[model samples]
Target: MDVDNTKPKPDTVTLRWSYSPITYFEGPFRFKENNCCWEFFDGSATATINAKYPVNKSQIKNDLNKRIESIFNASLIYNHTPYKVSEPFMEGYDSKGNLWITPVPINLNLSVSGPNIVIKDSNGNAIEDMKGNRLRDIEEFAKLSIKYSGDPAAQAILRNYKSAVGEPNSEFCHFYAIREVLTTRFWSATKVRSCLNLKKDDWTKLGKLCNEIPVQQGRHQGQKYEQFRKATNVELEEARIIVKTMVKQFFNYLQNSESH
Candidate 1:
């Protein structure tokens, strides 16, 4: 096969290939594709990513650092020497001891799973304990904790700032603040689910509410609400044991009587 050896090969860029957009909390977060290593008329090179997300180029070069490895696990895999993930980037090196600037093939991708995000946090005590708008449940709880912890006339500081540099009063305030935060955040919803025997669907309202968790936290409250609405086909697995048991017993009784 006659091939033109003149043109430079295309590079790989940080791009997301297999992802369900609905699962994300933010949008306008773009995805890219590159390294079509078979496009030119000469069949020499392909369109490809540029060795980094368009947002950051140096990220790939410095991805092998320890700070990145601490929060993220890095492994380089593929045609021999693999791709490694580093903070702010993922990079691949070829067998030739050279940086594989080409868009790393999907099968040869330098994947990074962590910096794991909390896809979901179900570490609360109870759900029924929440009131008001189901969508604002977490926020409502947070607001309550904050408001209740602060009082000028109160002897003990009720804030939850926990640090070594706290004054005597800061420590007291932080204690209650943390306690209330824990009870409301974890005990009220997630952790309490197993205790309550609540199935996943039983937590639908909570899930719906959680969808409103702003990807930007404080800024895009509206966007968070929209993201929840946009979440496609989010089904919760639920079971009512008593209901199931009763149905089984009824069926058995009918079956036995019919046989007799």
Candidate 2:
């Protein structure tokens, strides 16, 4: 419960289950942004299993001791901290004083229940039932305004758009989305950097265009849509067109590249 933020973050955080064949997870981290639960991804493939609950020392040694292997049937392990191992069923410290577990497998068809630590396969539909898999079966709604995952820049753009959707001005949010996508520093910068489609010149030009969109002063400065519009004389429709065009161009580039 008492997370020492001062403690260094782990080099990597991973979740594993008894049946998993691979040890690493890349992410969807569908839980509340950097929280206890994580959704991991690998390239275009994403794993839906989220260790949606936190498990500490007491729960593990107490309730989970007898069912120890079951507890570890689904576990979340962090590389930096040796003192902790969290499982879907329970979390706690073991006598080893270090995480001895190796990565088992990566599976997109798996889903974990937060409170009960139930394992569901791709066939299970209900949250409480463990007979089916939720992640593989359900149609994943676009968390971002537009679900564009072909590359990192597009993903960053869409995620920023999802975050800014409820703001006062949709146009400003769209601008922010464009800025984040083109900035090449948001979520997956490495992929964005290597993207041949979103070149440095393109990034610089987009950033300069967005710069004229003034930001607000003071506390809620990020919510600078009003001032941004007034100062830049940019219209909502224009912003939408820019974003849509970029999205289209990125996908088109991908198609062309793959054909070659």
Q: Whose TM-score is greatest here?
A: 2
> What TM-score do all the candidates reach, one by one?
0.16, 0.29
Clash count for each candidate, listed in order shown:
39, 20
Tally clashing residue pairs in candidate 2: 20
lDDT for model 2, please. 0.35
Give the runs in model 1 whose Cα sits over 4 Å from its true position: 1-103, 106-236, 239-260
Instruction: For candidate 1, give the lDDT of residue 55.
Output: 29
Q: Give the Cα-based TM-score of candidate 1 against the true structure.
A: 0.16
Full-model lDDT for every candidate: 0.27, 0.35
Candidate 1 per-residue lDDT over residues 1-260, each given as its tens digit: 24333333234433212221121111112111122221111111122344422325454333313222211110010011112321222334343434434344332222322121223248753444222222133222222222232222111211112120123212222332332343354456455344334454534433332333333212224563655322122321111122222222322333444568
What tens-digit string does per-residue lDDT give for candidate 2 at 1-260? 22122211233223332222122221232322112232332211111112222333343334222232211111211110111123332222234333333333443343333221355568875445321233322112222212233356655544444333334244454555655555454355345545534555554544444455454311234555556434243444344445444544554555566668
- In model 1, state the lDDT of residue 207: 34
How many times do residue backbones clash in model 1? 39
